[model samples]
Target: MNEFTMNDLMVLMPYAPIIIVAVTSLLAMIAITIQRSHFVTATISVVGLNVGLFTLIGQITGVIDSGAVVASAEQLFVVDSFAKFNMVVIFICALACCTLAYAYLANLKDNKDELYLLLLLSTTGALLMVSAQHMAAFFMSLELLSIPLYGLLSYTYMRNRSLESGLKYLVLSATASATILMGMAFIYAQVGSLAFKPISLVLGSMFESPLLILGAALMLFGIAFKLSAAPFHMWTPDVYEGAPAPIATYLASVSKVAMMALAVRFLIDSALLALPSVQMLLVVMATLSILAGNLLAVRQTSLKRLLGYSSIAHMGYVLIVIVSIGAAADSISSMYMAIYAFTSIGAFGVVTLMSSPYRQSGEADDLSHYQGLFWRRPIITAVMTIMMLSLAGIPLTAGFITKLFAILAAVQGTNWFLAAMIILGSAIGLFYYLRVMLTLFKRPKQFIEFDVAGQWGIRVGGLMVIGVTVVIIYFGVLPNSLIVWSDMARIW
Candidate 1:
């Protein structure tokens, strides 16, 4: 076999969409530094994402036409059907986030230009993460994907909660990073290699080694924290409640989807998910997350916090894909994740539009704030209604289809316990979702009027929410296109 070389790395780097995004971020940073123009900066960032997205499609088509999975020198990254599909979703989600951030930040008095820069940087990090094929790359990608979030979470400096969430995420994320590093150390001590495929090949009879399993478990612990799964999900609601609405959207969608992709890649490439110990651990986490997420959201009066808790359960549902083996499981998981991403965007986009940036009393995030919304703002009411229905997995929404996919995967894997949890959790989730819908028509609360309906920022955000809501309904009615696409994509 030919040896890995610097020339190969240099030639291959330009082929990845990550380079386009990274360069765009650099250019945006330069423009922001020269002149603090929020519109210019935001435009630059969005356009770059669009370019990166197109480049990604072009790259994938070229690779497929050539019928090859291209890994850079030293196998640090690989572009397969799975990477292609997930990366496409990441780009799309990031695009939506960019527009949402634009609308949300337009009303801000803070330095809005830098927030877009951080967003571009974070998007670059996520792209790097999804295609990582080596432990070193994975560890580096995790940090790249997380560090900018620390800044974004706290971007609204005037808000105490924003600052608090930023600090909370900083401390917790650092600890998680350390845990991941140590896990990598443990695995390296045994395998003497950090490339995923190599480790699997070298393990052979030693695949059941205590140290290896311990390392895998540690890594999963850190990842579960990122996914906000069950016991490790305590930080999720706090962060969601504290951060600005669009920032919360990024956390719920882009960050969640990227990590899930990496986790799936690690399990599949290392062949570790097949192990009984890992499988049982995953099932337990899945069960707790589903039950805990749905149960906790039941009592939430804060909409953002409720969605945060709800995300935990949705992630648990996504985990069903990880522990199961075969193409069907992978496809179903991707479908669920994509639906979750779009649903989250629509949900949070509505919140961002409804909440006031300069409200002395703070954002209009409470359930009472949305009560009787249908009387004053029928469009927002309809948008939020669809979001709630989708989140609840009601029929005629994309969420219902995702639930079906999860059930099929669970039964296919013979995981009856998890299948039962899926059913129970959705049943429990429906209660709170319907409660929110009821509030929309009851009586408008006299708390504090956000009165943002006339603002330009609100208009931009409102349109996006409506567009996303329409798509959700469309997919709910006809999911065959996405289903066929999912079947076409796979890691190998």
Candidate 2:
């Protein structure tokens, strides 16, 4: 039994971020019950996230330097430099999403307070997952992260597209969950243990066992679905298109980043990547994701849908880092994911600020919505352009730097095919991204029903987007700092 000890409480010191957010959710719920004020509830979430982020940063100095593995007595959770580094991004992005949600939820007719509750809960789960060391923790954290998203996606339940997207995600996500559960069961049947390290030890000898292979394969399929790689990615564009912009941003940045971090830790710790069956499954998924994401995004006019598809491609790119198993894979994965988070948030923040879930006119997500946008809002237009350019992996942008890292990792691992795919996908991405930029500068539409207030540029959501864009540009131009930080983050 994983009995509690006084030492256990001290061991949990490193988990302040997860604890703070989890506690905040409960407090926010209580405060809402006392008096339903969206502002108050949101304020609590924002303040709590900020506190947690500060706590995380405060520990960064000692945590990153030592690369210490702080685990619960029972090993349900474990925090290391890798977890610390990824948690920084997760916490910051959750803060950004909270800000965006605050702005987005203001005009909703329905109760808005609960959305913050769900967001906080999901964020707590994401934080927990980055450090999870046990099978129970992994599944619990995943569900905690996912279940709240169902409600958040349908928060604007009045819209037809919103409702449809919610149902689709619910059913599809459940199927993936089942698949993952079965895989876990299979692995447990053979190994008689659910802890990651123990499973790795067992699988090392029985790697050829049918039970182990089937278990690893089933788990990989479920993970691929979560990553939205290739054939399993059909749900991405619809989910992104259906969910509110902020919710979509959370999906693309926070949860996806956490999942990738977990995947990296799992592969390394469990040694599943040693199996040819696992490697082949991932290689095929990575290749298909690159091809499908880039090709499909070209024909899409909706910026949100395009991003949804593009995100799939980006994950595929990250998958290359995972499969490469190079010495620099961790460094590369961290840098790529950090840049991806900044760029994705900036991009979706633009959509969120431009469109309103509350408005009957629906989101300003259509390509036509931005025609001649530069003439009216060049600053905002500039932000969008930068996001698109970065995502296209244009030179001197963070996206370019991250994509370069992924390619370098592939080459280092001797994965020439994956390296080629990275190059090809980036090439294909330019076509549609350029299409988007051109639309921004086109003749202004006569029916200008811009959603936000005139002074919105300096507001919370606007500031968040601008801030993220600035980080993207800074990291892109001078990536040494980012690279050095990433290099410090390794799974011990």
Candidate 3:
């Protein structure tokens, strides 16, 4: 066996963000034990996340200057342009979530310091996931990302809905995990190795085997559940409705984005995209998700639930690009994800800020709650309107650009069916998105009191909304830079 030495440690220097986040979680736990000050814990968590993000940026620069770097751990972890790009997006989303959570959680009666700890852990898990190259690492990192979400989802245990949402997600997510594990076991049995390269080598011979096909389908099912695609997306609206606005935003944006990135990596590296049956299955899922998500959202009154369905549809659009993996797929998918992240965060941030902390009743999530929002809060209403428009894929918005990119990719790949599905979905999506926008501008029948406890949090959240709004508009208008960046992010 090779001797373990200090030099081996040097190889992990590029993974400083993951290491920093893990260490920060430990520190937060200890700090919480000593003095359970939410502010102190929040500060520590924010600082740690910023440090980790900066470290990741530095690592990326170093790599660009001196080629890609593989971790010392036998290539189980990789530090490449693709990993780095997705990590940056994940980190930004995590940071925004942290900032939003600080304000949102401060008014809660319970001890909220541990929420930051869970965020750190979950972020660390996301970082690990993007870098993971082997099956063991992938599953471990997936759990690391998921386990913390269970706690975060139910952080407001005082709410019955939160508890119910947590339980539902836990059960479904566990079932998916078990399915994935079974699939991985089946693949390993046939290939005798769990690494991507070796598995690809054997995939040709194993392609005709029923066992391999079943295994691949199961694996796809598990990933689809995480993506909240149709046929496995029943959990989405309930969870989004029950979870706090910030947590819902994280789920819709950060968590889904990371999972998609990993899926892209796995499919490309393992050459699993070569399977005809798999492609057909994905096409079906994408088509159904697009139709089901939009049709369901059209009838929803709850803004959170509506956005949940909207996410499902948006993810369906992304899947179209994923299925059409080609020269432009990476750029299109990345741009689409980035735009979605910005819009989702902005939309949810508005919901989060509008909520009343002292009320023991429902969140400010109903469509009626936003009536005459333009009269009450024009800036916020404008931001929300822009977000909704983006989601609807309207022109002069990031969503439109991204959707166009997806269509272009589908056409380039000769997936005319998927291209048509996207157009139909976008047209259907416009109705609900417009409904929300109209509600924002409608005159209220009665004046409703808007109460928020954390002024500082409101300011921070507002700033985040403005920031994301600016980005959405900027990219929607001039998307060249983002397009170039996404093009640079090659999976293999």
Candidate 4:
């Protein structure tokens, strides 16, 4: 029998955030059984998430002060600067989502307390994902992150779209997971290892093997599906349209961020990006996603769907920086993803806040729903406008800075094609984004009554809107701080 060592315990310390969330989830479930109260459960969830976030920050600070930390469990988990950076992003997004969910779930007719448990569990999975250094850990975390989403997506089980979305996601995600597992099996059979570093060490020698290449391709396909990149993005719009607003926000921000971090880690740490075939695949996918996403979004009347398509394009842009993995790639990718997360949260936060409590449909997601929004909810309208502008890459907004960073990364890597496609995509994106803005300010053909009556949830949501708006504008004006921070958070 082996005794536990200090290194083993130290390795576990970085996982405090995951541990905290998991415990809180169980406690929340127990509390739900003891007494079912939405406010009480929400309070517990929010407090737990906040505490988890703080723990994550402390771990990050320790890493910064001391050095990178790796778990003693066969080096399968690590808390390097890369992991810390992504964990911080995931925790912040989770916290914001929990805050938004408090209000969003308050008026729902269904049993809502359990949603928080799922949220915490999903976040725990995401935390595990970004820190996963081994393929086995990666797959386990992927399922953990995904399984809860099915419940969260179809939380409003009575609605037809909710049911459809959940079923679609469950089926598609299961297929993707199986594909990934197969790929992992193939790679394991060939390389005889599940850890990233060992596989990387042997990849060069086994580079010519058809099984290895096939495995890599399948894994990339699965990852691309999760990221909703290009042809694999078919499920995105339907899921976004059908899911509750807060859940949609979680999907767009938290889930994507975690997956992006994992994808980057795999590509870089495994040295898989060195292969020309892999590079070409990424480039092709990025190009198609950029062009098709923007083009398809132009005709969207549903704001949720529009944003879904926009996310596809945004991820394509992120992929551009990812493919150009150089000295600046990781920093640029982090900055780009951070800006996207904040702006996306702000965008969906407005949508979540505007969601009518009495509507059976869940959220008012249509273009007509927001017609003359500026005349009614000016603050939400302003926030939405900022987010849209940022998404469009307009100057003096975080989106513009993020786009510039991506373009710079492409230029630095001498990837002229991707740089041009990014510019083209941004230009195309502006039309739809500006169209939404125009609708917000348009004169209503007839006055529609709104429930101007406020609630605690709404007021808190307004504060979140204000907070995200300020961050967007601040970063847009003084981009240096975030840029420096992103640089410090480099993966490799």
Question: Model 3 shows how many backbone clashes?
Answer: 0
Candidate 2 has an lDDT of 0.87
lDDT of candidates 1 onward, in order: 0.83, 0.87, 0.83, 0.85
The C-alpha stretches of model 3 lying farther than 4 A from their native spots are 1-6, 63-68, 71-74, 326-328, 449-458
Model 2 residue pairs with clashes: none
- Name the 10 consecutive residues with the lowest summed lDDT in model 3: 64-73
- Candidate 3 RMSD to the correct structure: 2.4
Going through the candidates in the order shown, the clash numbers are: 0, 0, 0, 0
Clashing pairs in 3: none
Shift in Å, residue 216, candidate 4:
0.7
Candidate 2 lDDT by residue in tens digits, 1-492: 255564576666777678889999999999998999989999999999999888888788754222234453348888788888999999889999999988888788789999999999999889988888777888999999999999988888888788877889899999998998999999999989888888777776797989988988888888888889887999999999999889999999998988888777777778888888888888999999999999999999988999999999999999998899633466678778888988999989988998888665568899998999999888899999999999999988989888888888889889999999999999999999999999999999899866456887779989889898898899889988888988867877
Per-model TM-score on C-alpha atoms: 0.94, 0.96, 0.95, 0.95
Which lDDT tens digits does candidate 3 get at residues 266-308? Answer: 7777777788888887898899899999999999999999999
> What does candidate 4's lDDT look like per residue over 359-473, in tens digits?
6655778888788888867777888899999999888898899899899889988999899999999999999999999999998648554323355335766687779999999
Q: Which model is ahead, 1 or 4, in terms of TM-score?
A: 4
lDDT for each residue of candidate 1 in 1-492, tens digit (9 for 90 to 100)? 144575566456534578888889899989987999988998898899898788777766664232234564358877677877888889988888888787777767778888888888888778878788899889888888899999999888688888899999999988888888888898899888888877667667786899998998888989999999978999999999888888899999889988988888887787777567888889889989999999999999999999999999999998876675443455678788889999999888888887756664567788888888888778778888999999999889999998888888888888887788899999999999999899889977776476446653345566677788988999999988768877745777
Instruction: Output the TM-score of candidate 2.
Output: 0.96
- Superposed by TM-score, candidate 4 places the C-alpha of residue 262 at a distance from the truth, in angstroms, of 0.4
Worst 10 residues of 1 by lDDT: 64-73
Best by lDDT: 2
Better of 1 and 2 by lDDT: 2
